[model samples]
Target: MKNYWTISRKFEQNMNRLQKPKKETFKKRLQNYLIKFKTKSPQITEKYKYFLAGFIEGEGSFYVGLKKNSTSKYGLKVDPAFSVTQNKTGVVHLIAFMVLFQTGRIDFKSGSENTYVFKIENRQSLVEKVIPFYKSYVLPLTCSTKKQIFNNWVNVINKLDQGVHKTSEGLAYEILPLVFASRTKGKREKSLQDYQKLVLLGVRQ
Candidate 1:
């Protein structure tokens, strides 16, 4: 009877292990999540498409009151108490996360895809860095290997660890590209340069 109990215990343990996500299941889920929200709000999906498509890589539900105000040039007051989940889950949300990081706005109603400002002009550079990394590292991961999905989760956690978590003002921040106003200050600035600066700031987290 003791030997029988030991065999049953081993069987239950193996069953439990099988119940968790396997390598193939994880890959399938990741693909589905990436595809489902490519154009939807909570824009992390779109942002990561660029990351997943090329590079293979790379918040918050806190109610801390944002001391909202317009810096003189931007001439606009920001909203207060933005919400984020990426920080809590430490899970990267693609496009919406970028917009949230920039403007401190989590709600889809506040976002403007057409008007959203970004300074990721170095897209090519990022792509250059990411392509090789994905090819060398992430592309090798798959279901045939033991602990493959587990290893990939660890890699993701490590990557998110490197992301922005604070602003210059010391508020929490994200990786959304920020366009800073040219300090070169346009002389007699008859153009909308200052507004452009605010737009950058508004979009800059």
Candidate 2:
């Protein structure tokens, strides 16, 4: 009877040990899965570059946003951005974009769950990395509407980079028109005339 009791106790101890959970075991497994498919380094090859460009062609956007700013020389700011959106299932592709571009960030898309966006809004990054990459790999493969929008976006970026948006005349005659033209016709919140009026007011001030 004593021997049987001792053997039963040992069996219980072994069972408890096996039942205990390992710390971060699931997390580590997930990391390993992601690493398996993602580029481990920023020095990706030309094939991956073209793959990313094609991905962008279907899922990417080049946007120019206008916002009213109180302290600006023209009472307006031109916000230009490049972005690609994907659901959580495809987040590994977005991670590859981060690795390849060496700039931009991934964020949860506003107003939705399980959606992610890889965005580059920094002007320097746009000029140095995003713009050049698109011009080389993306532009040649874009559809007509996307191609036109991209060209307009590039013109806007170039103008802002050159300080051409500082004067009211430049804001009205040059920058604002491009901003207006870049959008789909019915999607504009304010008309070009309204923006021109604001520029005129800025000039009067």
Candidate 3:
């Protein structure tokens, strides 16, 4: 009887082990969830898309930066970026943005513990994914202020795409004016006159 009971217990343990589900890694689980989410109805997906656009209209930014870089033939580099910021408590939405856009990255905002930012700075991603997505979805829903900013930013990006910024004349006359127009007055680090002076200096060098 003792031997019989021990054998039965061992058999049950093996059965339990065999029946237990395999544990999925986090990446696998996330991929599965995304697959399921994508399989949702088109109406549902469209709603989500519009929701993201509205969220961006409220919280997103379109910006172009002029940073002095001596390594370039031009005195300044044109840095265009699109970003949305949210607190850590809202990180799930930020992740949704990354998944939807198929580009950009989410990171902890500098100097803040509970803040995060989703940003795209890659020129290709900006020109391809970000810009198209905005024009199709976000642009239609944007307010006047944001609309102007987006248009100005797009003009800068188009010039960069044309390789027009390679010449000092292009940087000074064509690109710099657009950059100045894109920025909010009084927010720039240097005056437009200061930037033109730097461009002239670069040509002299």
Candidate 4:
């Protein structure tokens, strides 16, 4: 025998050449990988993900504040915050949310008998982490009102990022009428006409 092993190797190569492996598309490859990995140890549990989304849909708020500030550049300050208010009995849930998200603070609602609010006021954290997470996971599951509010909030943030909030009076004028419009049970600012008057006074001063 010349070499049985060499002959067997050549035969296997010829067979593989006739029956080549199928090329998978990138989408399919990614799907397969996600399916394999999702079950192992997902970053967040399905229970927590949907629960948070639903809770926000029911009780959360996205607020973009544009108030007259004499000390700030352009005589205006932008305060963008996210909050979810719940009864005192649900403090544990709020705490759980804080632990899971690693952002926001739990506090008693002022002038409230049995209410607490979980609020996140850090601009950097909201833009970089919290907002992005909700946009991807929580937003889709929310109602149209919540979605619209979030979209407006994001618009304010984008304008702020471009320095439009500081320099462009037109931008602030355009956005102020939209902020806090959906707030139901909390401090609702005065009418847009009042705001316009205030802004005009600030510009004159």
In angstroms, give how far residue 29 of model 1 lies from its true place: 5.3
- lDDT tens string, model 3, 1-205? 9999999999999999999998765456445544643532122277788887877887887788888887878658889998999887766676677777666766788999888888889888898888888899987767787788789999999999999899888888888888878876675567877888888677433
lDDT of 4 by residue, 142-180 (tens): 778767778878777776677765544554476565554
TM-score of 4: 0.67
Q: How accurate locally, in lDDT, is each candidate?
A: 0.34, 0.81, 0.79, 0.69
Ranking by lDDT: 2, 3, 4, 1
* Candidate 4 Cα lDDT to native: 0.69
lDDT of 3 at 17: 98
For each candidate in turn, the TM-score is: 0.22, 0.75, 0.74, 0.67
Q: Which residues of candidate 4, in runs, are more than 4 Å off? A: 1-44, 180-189, 203-205
Q: For model 2, how does the per-residue alpha-carbon lDDT over 26-114 read when each residue is reduced to its tens digit?
A: 34544554575463433467998898898899889888888888778778878999899999888877877776666666778999888
Candidate 2 — what's its lDDT?
0.81
Off by over 4 Å in 1: 21-30, 38-61, 64-82, 85-205
Candidate 3, poorest ten consecutive residues by summed lDDT: 35-44
Q: On residues 79-170, what C-alpha lDDT tens digit does candidate 1 reach at each position?
A: 21213333212234434334423322222323443232111212232234332433454455523332243233223223334432223331
How many steric overlaps does candidate 1 have? 15
